[model samples]
Target: MANFNDSNVLSSTFYLTGIPGYEAAHCWISIPFCLLYLIGIVGNSTILHIIRTDSSLHEPMYYFLAMLSLTDMGMSLSTLPTVLRIFWFDANEMTFDACVTQMFFIHSLSLMESAVLLAMAFDRYVAICNPLRYATILTSRRIIHIGLVLLCRSTVLLPPLLIHLLWYPFCDSHKLSHSFCLQQDMIRLACADTTFNRMYGLALVIFLWGVDSLGIIMSYIFILRAMLSIASREERLKALNTCASHICAVLILYVPMIGLSMIHRFAKHSPPLVHILMANIYLLVPPVLNPIIYSVKTKQIRRRILQLLAPQRCFSTFK
Candidate 1:
């Protein structure tokens, strides 16, 4: 008899036990998801490496991009593995402890990403609206302090939140309807009353991510209006173009996020299978698209990416 505590035994046990019901044909879905996950890792890693190695990108905007890439990496890691398992292994059976861990990370990283967006918006506002004092206002020390503060604040949410999840009683059908463990899906599995989880989750989303996104939107509106009043066409174009990448990023990040919240809240009656797909989109799409948005819209990143990858191609030196 193999002891469950034995490392190799446990690995073999949970791996093949796959999701409870939908194990068949999960392979088809796993292939595409695996591809997307690979892209997310490579893209985000490139941004992090380039930002760190290239001294030229050591400004406030790229500093925010570094944080964004870090959060994107965190966000993808939190949800993607479970999703891949669900797709390939039929592994819908998450123990209560594992479920809570997943929820904590997914929520924490989601919050961190939102905070990074707000910081990016502030950076853009300073760069476009007040170019002269940009360095003075957003010094390296200041940026690092803000990053630490954001990390600390977002992290503090987890201990209390996970404790809240543990308060719930588990149902017999511990299988999560969603491919991944979501706060909503976990709450739905509660045998005891789950009134608190729903209310608490909604409240946090509203006050935290909701407020941050609202502020970002307002910042851009003011920026655009201010751009209109500028005298020189060159200056105006420069200001707007600088913000172009930031705006695209905000839209791609927030739109699906808000949609996911709405779907969880309002579309409660949808089939679990449908909700599973939605959750995948919510978690996966942003990271997959974010690097593309930055690479395409941000001139500096585009040039750096080209330079960084240029060595891989075979360019001939003519005699």
Candidate 2:
């Protein structure tokens, strides 16, 4: 075990682990991961392109959805290189600074996703609960301000906590149990007392994930309440339908996150494959599914995609 007082800690390289008991299957496993990475990247890029080209998607709801797509792309890119390297070439080594950098982006982008989801929920609430004021409430300027605030909130609060990792002296067993770095998994490698790390991590989780989740739930509750006041069944259904994609997005984002947290904190003695599977699902599922869900559920986006795929057909139909 190394200590904080030691100089060697600054120069150490940490080893990353893949599916622990299935080293022989790494190449095979990389296949599915590669597919997911491609889908997430291309899908998110397509969403961004469509949003930018279509002037009709200039509203607050679509703008927030665009932010969500961007964050998902960011999260996938942050982990993709290291994950592929570990699976493809058996290269699992990362320097201290690199690990810290990965951890910061991975976790911060995750928090940003949560914040964006909350913003989307707010957009829905305004559209449903106060339809008359939706435009006034979520102006383009306000939306831009919200995005900047979310960006600042996610990027700013993390570094002060993560900077402490550099000060800790690590143990000889610097193996992190994933293809990429996580503050939780990496902090355990430190030989010094990680009481502060553990506590601060807990606070961070509660503050970010906990608060964002609660806000989303509250927004939905208000949405449901507003829907109930609408006497017509079809109108109520239509309103609820608008929220379905966002509801699916929220579920996909949070369910795996909760499972990963449970496995990390409570299932310490569980199989390594279980942890690895949950972690990968946590990282991979949302990026791949979010775009698909939105494209299917949101008619405007779906129509835009078709127009992009078959522009002559779109032009002929318009004629």
**Residue-wise C-alpha lDDT for candidate 1, range 1-319, written one tens digit per residue:** 1432343222221121233355676787678888998899899998888888889888888989989988988888887777777676655566656766777888888888888989889888887777789889999999999999889878886676568765554533455566556677655655567777677777877888877888898888878878988999998988888887777777777777777767777988876665556667778877888887888888777777887667445233211
Worst 10-residue stretch by lDDT in candidate 2?
1-10
Q: Report lDDT per candidate.
A: 0.75, 0.91
Q: Which segments of model 2 are wrong by more than 4 Å?
A: 1-11, 317-319
Worst 10 residues of 1 by lDDT: 8-17
Question: How many pairs of residues collide in each model?
Answer: 6, 0
Reference-based TM-score, model 2:
0.96
Candidate 2 has an lDDT of 0.91
lDDT tens digits by residue: candidate 2, 65-99: 99999999999999999999988999999998898
- TM-score of every model? 0.87, 0.96
Model 1 error, position 222 (Å): 2.3
